[model samples]
Target: MAGGVAAAVLGAIGGAGAYAYAGEVPRGTSVLGVDIGGKNRSDAIAALHAGLAKQAGKLGNPVAVRLGDRAAEVTPADIDLGVDVEATVTVAIEASPNPIGRLLGSRTVEPVVTLDEGKLHDLLGTALGKDARAMKQPSITFSGTTPKPNYPQPGRGLDAARSADAVRSGWLGGGPVDVPIVEIHPATTKEDVDKLVAEFARPAVSAPVTVTTERGDVTVAPAAIAKSLRLVADKAGRIEPALDAKKLRAALSTPLGAVEVQPKDARVAIVSGKPRVTEGTEGRQVDVTALATDLLAVLPKSDERTVTGKLVAAKPATTAADVAKLGIKERVSTFTTKFTGGLGAPRSQNIVQIAKDVDGTLVKPGAVFSLNGHTGERGYRQGYRDAPVILDGKLVPGVGGGTSQFTTTLFNAAYYAGLEDVHHKPHSYYFDRYPAVIESTIFWPDLDMKFRNNTEYGVVIDTSWTDNSITVSMYSTKVWDSVSTEYSPRRNITSPKVIKLPKGPTCIATNGIPGFTQDAFRVFKKDGKVVEREKFTWTYSAEPRFTCG
Candidate 1:
């Protein structure tokens, strides 16, 4: 009975095979929603193309793409986005190549779409606007003059491969699909910045800078300038070196300032109608500005760091005997300056330091005395703190911030005293505490506030200060009968730019102020006649402050 049943099944299969061999297509065979059943090969091919004519006209009916309301339409034809009809037809045709398989089983062919991936890739690339930054993989770049890694910035774009796969999958699975075009994004990270900082920047501050001279070598430890060395972004938004000029100048202050000597000029005075002659002396001074320039050359070295520079001489053109015959008498000029004190602690410390250095300083006949030479270095160990210092025309925290206030005091005192002008630099910005157009700024071992004693007699410096007030008094016998001052209103006044930063852990806030330029003059009178006159100009910088979260 079992054998008979098997024979009946075999006969049924054979009959089905015979029927399939004689037939073209059974009844229902469709592809891409096009029915090709019971049709010949040529008819099926024609039907395939006709059914997909609408899909080929994808430009007219584009697939709607949306990324969080950022809508974009993509033409499938433009991207060569279409089904592989021939391959799909081959798959359909091959499904029932044998008679038994054709009659006994039914098969459905999902078209295998073929597209010009390069063109698709290009289409995806153009999907974004020029303003839309493409996602970038993390990479190292030596785009700068120096050899170092640049930190990466975040960006966004459509994911090419995954998006293509999704398009094909949707078409094959369901006809109605509003593709949720997934967005690919670059890492929103500063990890690269952190990495470079760890790998290079932090290690750079590990060793002290060895500045070698023929006489000896001086070391500026990392601790001194490390805080000043910042990983600042360049114009291209790459991390670069930000060596604080103020900090570097302050750090090199002592060693270099020690090498300088204030020149002595011959002193001559009239006493009992006899001219007394004081000897002239030679002197040496360090070229600290040049040293600052050379710092970049030697700082990033494994070994051998030495720099040599020219020293400026304070040479007296005339001897004391030569000037003695001129017959100049006492009390030429004198002036006083007052300051509002009750200062901040950092400023107070700097003021006290400067006042101590300036007091008891003597300016002799035909001689020059520099405030910097007298004060030497303003070092942290020497009572200076990381207060706000002016740098690159901006006031920021540095080692000797408030010292400039003293510069104003001494400079104005010398100016009103009818002293000879030498060299003085004014602040970049105006401060209410300082007298406008009549102020000074100093960077030790480089810039200085100097005045020459053109008078025959010597002038003495006296200083007194409280928390709320301070005074600078220059005492000398009157060479000019009186000294008076004139001034011009600020010209070329400009306002500062305000910068805003997003609210974050790195947010910082600073208030900005305006800038201007002005001039002041001192007139000296002897017997009510003008004997000498001097002029001083100040160019204040516009300080741009930051506004933050």
Candidate 2:
């Protein structure tokens, strides 16, 4: 009998919970001064819409905002500032959940309002633009041959943060809101500008300055000084004057060119099938940094406008002693790729141009060399002619078309040299001109081939080409006794699709080639033992058959 009584009590509690969840909203609930108590979800939403509509009619009009003495009007709809009716109703329903609490509780919810602070800030800036002025700091810059001075000025602007809060709280109340306007002061004042101009700028451009170095003396004209001079205001409002080192160096180079001796870097060349090192020479040049400092010290002087700059010894980037220690004594690896075009052909010209740039490049030990980084952009500006290049599986006339052949040659040379392959991407489609899966394609700034000389010895890249073939050779201490490649049989073969198009300059008709996936392994041997083995794989897309109508 006790178990039966407990079961009846539990059933009554569950019924009460379900009725409360699905029943009308909690009693005596209100939002934005609108009574929505004891109503269903739909009825509550309808009541909120009807009641808020009347309130919006009064408050939705253009609101007047005052910033300092300036006044502007903004409509609530223009800034997306208004109350959300459905959201307000949702808050009311979720306020009281317990059945007993819903029966006895009375709650008031803040209305759900929407306001885009960013939009309101921008509106305030534009509306009160006359009253908003940015503080101008003192500065001096050149205007043609004369130095121009800009004086500092105090300003005033609307404080967007406090003003946004005011609009949020009072805009809905349907009254004119007063936005706070704050005064802005420049870090520097007009007095600083006047002092800088009088003591530095005026005298700096009055006469030519003479820089005496160990090599000789060079006179910089007054006009040159005006162009290279820079006067800027610091955070503490102090005016600072400085000479642009790069600009001054360029301006003084020609006049001092004869007296200055440029440094020469050591070079490596192949002589009698062996690497030969040429000694570098040290040269003397003007010390621009010290000259600038010295010039600043005497620039304001009326009579002593000459400054003596200490001549510092300029060393070559690579000295002969440095190159002699690099252990580049013999040819370590060499690779060649064949091309069919004649010397006058655009493709052949591009291939030769790239080979010229790649020739005589020295890769330091543990340094990664990138083809794109070294050669830069290969466009018409770089003298690369337009030739047939593969694009979207079709051959189109493009610049730097034949440079990829050179890239393939260089990749094979670096591969056999026992260097670490940092990054290399193969062509999307297979071409019979290049070795199946072992070749790489290159584009300006994007696709590239890179290799790192991981050995302790440096490697020198030497390139040579004939009308029909290009060869790349690397000279270094041979770490790998022998390097060879093993190939895996092609798989996942797919036939090309036949694509017909109208005959146009953009289309190049071709017989399609089959695509397949293949892998190549590079084995490095030292003392007749396998030291390292690297695996490379690529999947070639089937070249579509193009038939021009």
Candidate 3:
């Protein structure tokens, strides 16, 4: 027919240029619709890698596209479509029923991607920096410590900014920090043990050491230890070795001694068992070692001793050759005269004619006698001073008013010789011709009379007088054998008043005579039994009869 119809139009233009060099997609091209028409480029790149691996499995990753200015990693093996690349494209569209009218004529395509944008920004910065490091959050620190500060533990801490930055970064650990140390710990309380025992106690000061000793002698009384430490004496507190001068020279040579006075020598004729009278005088032999060297030159010498002496003995003297050496025998008396009743007459010489003129002798055995050596002062020219005188009661001009009745008849012959009355006085009133207890009296220096030969046997007194008879006789060694008297016939009698005279011769009657009362007794014997019996009483008043003009 016209050359067979022009070879059928050149094989149909060589099959449409082999479907555009094999990257085909024309028969009802609906790629994801299961219709890749002539499907060349390796089956249209295997259907565009199964349609982008189903859109990259629903876009789970790898997919950036925009080619031209570069940006392409379309994974799924880079959508080869069998590699005809060159900005690949193939199309022959159909299927328009609104699938976007079949993808709008479909064929506008390119995909030969290969990209590494710095490894995709290092895999998206290492997968978004590993998901921003797994969304992090953790932090919290701080450290400081010091500990153990002994004693009262004075290392304070309350976390002072973490112990001052742990003492400037010197580190310690365990976070919640707080440290500071130094330890000791002991003093509990009582003011912290009195400030730790006042920093270790000890204060009783004042010491001057020096205490030498092998044991013994220690006198530390420095003012009693300075008044027991209250201090003073220059704050005293230090004595030693100053006062034992050999124990103060043995305590001043031992003191404490005195009290002495011994004397002995009393032999009044063996206490008067007597009969004495020995005459032997002659004694004058003193030289007693030159009087003990002149009394040791007036005593005192032991280094001129301060006080302490000895030399006793001095008491002895009673001579008349010590009473004729005690052998006994001496008597002499015989001078008599009589004439009672005349001599200025006053009722014919009364007072019993002056108790018959003085007569004396009687004192023996260990005797020491003297009454001016036995009476002998009767002067008035030896005529008895103005004779009859009793003055204040009548008769005047007195001289010794009847010489105390011649000492009351020689004290009744020395109390009938048994004497020992060493001193006597009686007559402040009552006076019955004297004899009231063997009366005796005188007043020359205010009355006096004494006796003492207390019979150990020795007495002799024979004296006689006459102006009207007076006699006194006594001789002993007969120590009483018989002597008698007994009288008790007077009772409570008082009368004789009249004493009113401020200056007038008022009721002047100076005791002349009136009241009277009596009682008397005396009996002494030895070999005849009845050894002693003595008693006497005489009370008389009523003698007030005065008249003075």
Top lDDT model: 2
Ranking by lDDT: 2, 1, 3
Q: Model 1, range 343-462, lDDT digits (tens) per residue?
A: 667766777788877764656688799887887888887778766676655445677777777788888777777777788877777777777776788887788998898877667666
State the lDDT of candidate 3 residue by residue for 308-426, as single tens digits. 22223434343445434433342211112233554444322433333333222335575744343455454455344534433343334455555555555656566555465566655
Worst 10 residues of 2 by lDDT: 16-25
lDDT over C-alpha atoms for residue 324 of model 2: 88
> What TM-score would candidate 3 get against the native?
0.23
List the global CA lDDT of all models. 0.64, 0.84, 0.39
Using lDDT as the yardstick, the better of models 2 and 3 is 2
C-alpha lDDT of candidate 2 relative to the true structure? 0.84
lDDT of 2 by residue, 31-114 (tens): 777888878988988887888887877757888998777788888888888877788788877766577766556778777777
| Highest TM-score model number | 2
Clashing pairs in 2: none
- Candidate 2 stretches with Cα past 4 Å from truth are 1-239, 243-262, 282-286, 291-314, 501-504
What's the residue-level lDDT of 290 in candidate 1?
Answer: 60
